[model samples]
Target: MENISAAPETQIKETSFLSLNPSTLEVIGEVANTSREEIDDKIEKAQKAQKRWAARPDAERKEIILKVAEALQQNSKHLAAWITREQGKPLSGPGANFEMQACVGWTQVPASLDVPEEIVFEDETRKDILYRNPIGVVAAIAPWNWPLMIAIWQIIPSLRMGNAVVIKPSEYTTFCTQEMIKVINTVLPEDILQVITGRGEVGSYLTSHPEIGKIMFTGSIATGKKVIEASVKNMARLTLECGGNDAGIILPGFDVSKHIDQLFWAAFLNMGQTCACLKRLYVHENDYEKVVKALTDYSSHIPMGDGADEASILGPIQNKMQYDKILDLILDSEKNGADVLFRGQKPDLEGYFIPVTLIGNVDNGHRIVDEEQFGPVLPIIQYKTLEEAITKANNSENGLGASVWSDDLNEAQKVAAQLQAGTVWINQHGAIHPLVPFGGAKQSGYGVEFGIEGLKAVSLPKVISIKK
Candidate 1:
């Protein structure tokens, strides 16, 4: 972390820290390094505000949330550009612009969803009704990757369920989230939605605050565990979407020529910074060479450069920490005699840029194949039988998502069913819909996000019984 400078030119104060563009290392701006005192004050205010906010009619809350979506639409271009600059995702393609659109769409979808009262049991003499109620103030901890979109994922559903939110964005990408919260606050009532920006300690304070009734977090497994510990003090309800080293399996009869492009993007979308992107690929020995060759050829033509350049579809690694980690993993793989099948050419520019790379002749035990690289590197593993592929794919501690690729839908569905993941796709990887529920399994953390279940996750269920 960079220290606050007294230099007048940078205008960085002791109370705030710099936000930089990862591709250029230029200062995007400074965001407040919120103190623990400020966090406690914000949480207290949010709790007071939540009472009035939750008391409003559900229809009125829905209307206000829809207005928030409209406000986001009006400021889409400005917000998207800021996101590209601060977060290091390209402005076009499935980058910052796409993420802004997703923010609006996610907000609208949650607003439209209905968590109606349910009649769980009914008889002539007695009846029971289940109701969903707001859990008061919610603490949202968002990750740097997909910062604005993931913040939206946390904020909208909490607000839709009538809970006040105080978001603590990743220090690496704070300005974009602060900017987004600024836009959203224009349409929301005072103190209903707030952003407390800082490093990890700020988040620790916010999560541990006793006034907070629930927590919604998306980040690494290690951090999620810390959050769980913090929540224990308040006994806060938690919805944690943690790390995922998702896998994709290619069946023996898969057509590499027809689906090669989709497969490449599935793994490399957002420069493979996504939590659920295909990290490990298991290919049947019969189609191993064809799958490798097709992916290499397709990736060779894609461009990598500054996020501002419209021609560049892929951008640099978002920060120095992740960039160095990816390089070390590649070096370690090479030291262990893994074959580097294809490495893309980097743009002749200075930045935290890493070329797109694909490794072959790697097995499950290898470090590169075992851990989540979370960058522009994919390791291809070869298997002899479907059972072997399934076993190797399910061998990881992280099981957020997985996919089975084949022309035969029936066989693909069967393979999908056998995989140990929260969401399994037939031919697509990391394609999520706002209406469908998505989360992780095993060490990837618990609780679901999106749709009605997501809304319920942020709310409490109360059963009412009436005897006749």
Candidate 2:
């Protein structure tokens, strides 16, 4: 309910965009501000479009994907500029480029890739066969933090697997996604790949809507559970890539300095607005003080707040609620006997900024360590043996990602395997490749994104039998 609408930008293109800013809560775009009835129309259009899209050959469907890639690169500068203006992230660098990187990730399907027919023969008499076919209409509700990339992560795979997609982006950053879709619609039929704009009500309408064949979402777990409950009417296939308070273990080694640098990037990249950011860190007690000292010294050099200029390392907290929740968690951690080592402080009211905070003596129950802070905050807790460290790492309900750092690759590998997470890192953190599948276990939610598994998430299996 902050009606933060602004006067439309002069000469803005016509689209179903929303009037919201990525950093400062100002309304500065030409947003359609579509109603629920209008969205209902788009859904109907998408349903009709899917019939033709599904009727097309798989290769033709894949061609549209490559066309999307070409359009993205040609419009990369425009996209990056839009991202910076909308999200307030670094415009010319890593932050601005991820949207393009994500677009390129799905440009082409793997050559020589075959989802072969799987044949199951129990006895000589009966045979069961399985192959893959496309699901009908996919309803994708993506988060705003990384609007273009997250949307691409959801949209591209679903589209590539031959399913028509209907995307509902977070209200805060719908402009960027709408811009992304604008480029793709040039080559793709508007009905096949469409984006609808609105708040939670719009998303709720889509989730429970009977026409959708499946729901793939990325956001907080609370909302994720709601989607699951709402999907029961049609038993829609669901994949929830929820939250993560991911942990990292740094072992004593000669190159611990390098590992500390890696941790700094992971802890504060995108202003620590990452799901798999290294939130909880455990260092060997012998070198614990040294690691903290090195991190604090290095961290001080990296500035925070409003990453509009290319030189700034971190940006604003995306929105106000996230800005406050970060401060609240730090306070709760302090109340729970956690020591505040290095706390980032910026009093500029214009920038919704939270400093890069590091906490010490964090336990299993502390909010700083237990839940996903989703900010530029790092907490350090000490542990003795490898088992104790692994025990602490696996104690959380989140199993999204974890890491171990040591000069000894074997030791790091050993610890990495022991951590109960989807992706593990050795000597590095947040190093991701598009070809690798990543997700979480326990309360971290389900389903894998990227790599071969990602392609399969939106694909349905079918069996054709040949009997003689």
Candidate 3:
């Protein structure tokens, strides 16, 4: 049975922002846009609340994070439904349940972390200590893709370390994010964790606001640059995670049937909307044809339909602008002599459904290979040498994440070490843990998230010395 919701009527007059279910192109709900005055009020409140929050005992703060996790668990079903309705990620697979589980993990793991004071020096004559200090009010700008999960990654660490956070979720997925925040707020103090909703202008205002001490933003490279520009006026500490054209390489000798599913899904998770999803693939000549045929056969079985449908493993493109961009890239790739190895069916539906497309025999310089498509399209290139594959993978401006696949572990490890990305995976891609630190290199943006280092990213340090 198809577990899907029917489209709601198009009535957008009263809402400042209308959220559409990408699978059905139906209006999910209306959201209010924040004004400059309201933004000012929230910032001021956050500033005040941060001071009180920071003064609380570490035990008290930890308990609150745990409570928030419990609340999220209780409301998982409702939140998951909202996510599927607005974001178009199928509920059964990587949709709401997956996100909620991730959220719980992010919140609990960071809450459990303890950033103890570092004893720099200790002698009879003198003692030195370094401590992690909260950086007042933080403004977190989240993206449309993986809205709640990313927000949890941002907000939980900030709050756990005793800083108040003001979150600005993408307008595309605002309502569900607002609801997620609301659920957590039942366990948090007022203004300690607040939500601000609007378009880019609101984000610019918040980033530039003198009262906001730090900014954490996740989005496109173009917008990340703009965020850096706006934060300069306030000189706020910034942690920015921008775009990534992640690459995956298959070694010459690999079992195609055993690993093809991993290769295909890693590249197309969330319908290829994930920031660290493998956008490019390089296969050694010996394994090129075998890998192509295996991957094509694997993708044929995964159905694409409304996110609400339990049988649908993938959903529609989240928005029109991205849909058009993917189409442009595909047309350009065809013009550049790329051959199509596999193309999913083009459904007779109104929503923005682009079938999973794989173009083979492409070279590195092609736009399809160089740029971050951020859609359901991947370009697979054939390389004669491992060195050539490494060079081609590192050729792009982004170095967020990359992977090396091989049946031989030693050979895969040797090549994985050479890939110039923040995180390198062998036999897998984009799999991250809370205790491990993940960030970008090169133009992918700076500042790391996750682990004790991530807690320190949202905090400042103070050194104290005692002389005897």
Candidate 4:
């Protein structure tokens, strides 16, 4: 453990945060509590840079952003190790390198997108056109889970569309995000893309800053509201990707035994720390026992250990706050009479590790089923009919993502269409891509994150009409 307790920053620092190895509870590094003065300076620089960066031909901007993609691919190995160590996700599997590779794909996709002006009407009598103009100085705030990839999702399109971005990553994963920005800065002008580190107050300052033209955030809904409130100062554009209690429906006659592994990972990947992960599962009454048994068998074979261990598939809960929340939900489920079908074993280690937990026979209103647990624990509820399942899945305040599974593809598609979610999947969950438009419908969020629609969200639209 690197102890900087006596460091100068610690002596004068009003506040600071630590990045720990959740698998061992060891302090991996520390992030300074950046002042409002520092944040304002960075925003000023970004605003000045945005004018020049946006003035360059779109072709020139596209080439430099593509070079960033190549740099991310080249540094995949180093990033993977840092991610695993700082964030406690696996190193080899779907952990560090997997996210890095995905960043490359996400960065490259927007570079190829076309954001051309549209002519609505052209005639001898009149002419009408719509043009997309960049919103200057975007504030990109990313969460700890999927930090690098989500940061790319936020800034890539903004930059490609000609806006400069100031990114504030979660203090827990600042190391990797800082390095990622460093790699990108090699091809970008100074302050065009900058990384700042701090706590919640710092985020509040950035959101309230008048210079920030837009704020793109991904995190809890409570914080989303705060962001919205702060943005009222400047009436800055806001795109919030908030918390989700995503539900997965296992339709009748779907072979639970066949897709059990997919179901397990869909809910448990990244120790269930993902924002769009399936937190609640609804199974047909006919297949409830089979689904439970299949999940139990699948989870028993996987191990939870230190992220550095090659054999470990799942890592710790990433932070103490999340670990404690997962524990509270499990206790509440047990008290509410939900049966524990298979509770994973807790390892004798110092890290924040919780085993894969499946609580069955859970009623609809149980806290475990209602809230976004955001951990390794999942609640499997039973539904007597397709109508009941669809109703329960769409009954949440969150409308981020949902999935319907069945052997019959048509049936799955039909049920998927009725669910009130932004992105509905047939036999899959949380598989977001760069080309598809991903956003929330109701409380989950408002604006999109990918595709042309996403590009437009970061831009201000100007319409022109002329009378002949």
Candidate 5:
């Protein structure tokens, strides 16, 4: 059918800040809000291609994907610039090259994670061998935080395993994702990987569609729960990479003076929008004062402005609701008797900028301490014993990721082991590689992604018996 929605833009202007010239917030780009009918039609077209893509030899499928990866690498500069302008991030930073890395991973499909693993079993007179196969079509609904990188995380492995994909991006940040798809479609077959965009209604339609075999979604926990309920009719296989109120524990022996700089960057990168960003911190009471002082002094010095300015350290909150939520959490924190460690007033302008606010002595009762305030806000809670600390850390419904900091490696390892998070760090944050598996526990949702585990997620395993 070769069906895809024609991009509405006739002019390709630099799509950074779409509103005010001196605006604090970054605009990325404006999508010409699409309709549900158009999206459904696009899904039907992708479904047609998906069936044919499934019939291709696995090697033939990989050959076309390798070309897509090459195109991504070639246009990486263009892609990075687009990410900065459209996503309100720095021109160059830790995550600056992440999208490109995703492109490479998606296109190359590294050997370490390849499956098609053999299986064996025996029961008296019976013998069995195993096989792995694709799950028809895979559905990827991406979030805005890591737009293309997260999309690649889902699409690449799914495609590599011989499953076709229909990608639905967040409406708030769909332009760059759409443009990336356009560039990709320019070089590769459009039927294999198709881009569909709209608000919730369109997403709900495709997600609830009868034809989809499996669904992978990365977003809030609330939405994740809803996705699970919606898929029951089809009994679709699913992976939900939901939100988190991740913890960072500073152990008794870690010298606060020695690692304050490292801690600051970990807590504030991408203005703390990351799922694994240090949303909550538990410090031993003996070292609490020293650590808080260092964080306070260091945080006051970082400049804040728009992401495109090149000099700004923290950009505005990615969207509006996040802006209000950050402020509300701060107020609630203070009301619950926690100490405000920095500027609590949100930027008064229309742009969504909330000052980097760090609070301490926040108990579990407070929303700031308990909830996933996914902004550049850090809350500190003091713990008396290692038992209390681990108990408190694991108290939340979320267990997506957590970190422990200590110069005493043994003590840190002890606590990291006790914490009930999916991914734990010794002294760093947001340290992810393509080979490692990542996901969560409890209300943080379930399943894993990346590396061999991620590749396995894109398919179904089976047992094949051969005559002896």
Candidate 6:
């Protein structure tokens, strides 16, 4: 999801911005800032085209979406390259290549899902049947963190439910989204899917448009509030997935050696930019020392450098604003007496590079612990008891996801039940399956996405009753 950092500069004289490579600060490409009139025109055309598209047989729609997924696979290398350049993720590991593969995989699953009519009640005297119908048009506002994959998350389900979509991707990754849409539109009918590129104003205008029936947004809590206000204008059906300061708890008797690698990637994936990544880690005091040492040793050996380099597993922060914010948070933590267990080497190159860092001797009230840093820094807080750990983990207002680490299945499941987050992981974190429904609790936002529930989110339900 998009960071709570500064919004892209508003378009004034120039109607475009240069997309830059975060690793080298080099220009990748330029994208036009879509105007209000163009957005209106696109929405109107989508409204007209959706009727005919929705009239097509369900099997035909499914076949077409499957073809789109095939097209994405065929073009995976090219698409992965764009993602590496526009967003600062490595080409290997769980980076650009992984994201491209996920895009294809996510698209196919929604196409294969069955949304059938349901018989609610049946009797000799009366009958009731329920149908899933398409909402007129869906507006998808995507974030830069996982631009292509999240767009597919929003678009594929909407199209499967027989609705046209108009997307507004984050300015930081607009061209990358455009490239993915370019591939998708080749297999789709004209006006069935479209992307409008620009700064925040373009997204605000798109969401507030009267013609939009349902809106899907993934971004910051600050911006999510704005989306909720805009939806009030039309009372648009909304599925909002906002920012998360997710926490992970390490049980007292858990073996730190066996799961160290899994735990490392869960937090540092995408340099800890993901909304659902573990932002704060609570370790029982009994296991705190061993856990901290193991994590530091594991993180020190990992490579961090330019994304295009095959040897690098991690890359620079995607933007300068975020890079600076991370530094500020670390500095504050140190000033507040948090111990720096390990800080990775910074390559002798010019870019937004901050290596892997693990902070210890931190507590719940520390700003680094309380706020969503959204970077490669993780603060480990120690707790005296399981109750204390659970209380600390549940203290955050953002409850998108949380994890409990332990070898005891029954004990872990019991701990997971007490967590207030939307989805609790027992032994893993940030591992999302396409078939499961995923959403947040509290201010993290509501409305689930993925699986049959996701298909229903993009469509409307109607009941038909008959007198026998």
Model 2 lDDT per residue over 1-468, tens place: 111111211122234554545456667675564555666687789888888877887777767677777888889878877777677676644587765775666454431134556776545556678877778788898876787887888887877776788898777777777888898788887688878776666677677777888888888877877777767756789888887888888876536676667778877778788777788898778878888888898888776555566766666777767779988998998888889899766636476677788899887778788888888888898877778888998999888888888889987888788899888988777777777887878777798877777778788877666553
Per-model C-alpha RMSD: 4.2, 5.2, 5.5, 4.1, 5.5, 2.3
Candidate 4 residues 1-468, lDDT tens each?
Answer: 001111112222456767788888888777887786788788889989999999999998889889999998988888878888888898756777788899999999899888898999999899999999999999988888888899999989999989999998887788888888888888898889977787776677777777889999998877787778878877899898986889999988898777777888889988888878888899988888889889999999888888888888888887888889889989988987889989898878899989999998796789998889999999999989889988999889999999888899988888998999999887778888888999987788789989888889999999899898
Rank list by lDDT: 6, 1, 3, 4, 2, 5
- TM-score per candidate, chains pooled: 0.96, 0.90, 0.96, 0.96, 0.89, 0.97
Model 4 ranges off by over 4 Å: 1-13
lDDT, residue 335, candidate 2? 88
Q: In each prediction, how many residue pairs overlap at the backbone (N, C-alpha, C within less than 3 A)? A: 0, 2, 0, 0, 2, 0
Off by over 4 Å in 3: 1-15
lDDT of each: 0.89, 0.75, 0.87, 0.85, 0.74, 0.90
Candidate 4 accuracy as lDDT: 0.85
Tens-digit per-residue lDDT, 1-468, candidate 5:
001122222122222223221234434345543455565566678778777877887777767777788888888878776666556655545544655666676557542345755657877666787666888777788887777888888887887777778888776667778877877787656677877765555566667667788889888888887778767756779988887888888888678777777798778877787777888889989888888888988888776765556666666777666668888888887777888777634434456777788898787778998899888899889999888888888999899889999898887888888889898988887677778888888888788888888888878988877555
Residue by residue across 42-109, what tens digits does model 3's lDDT show?
A: 98999899999999999999999999999999998899888888888889876778999999989999
Prediction 2 TM-score vs. true? 0.90
Worst 10 residues of 6 by lDDT: 3-12
The best candidate by TM-score is: 6
The residue-level lDDT of candidate 3 at 312 comes to 85
User: Candidate 2 or 5, higher TM-score?
Assistant: 2
Give me the overall lDDT of model 3: 0.87
Clash count for candidate 1 is 0
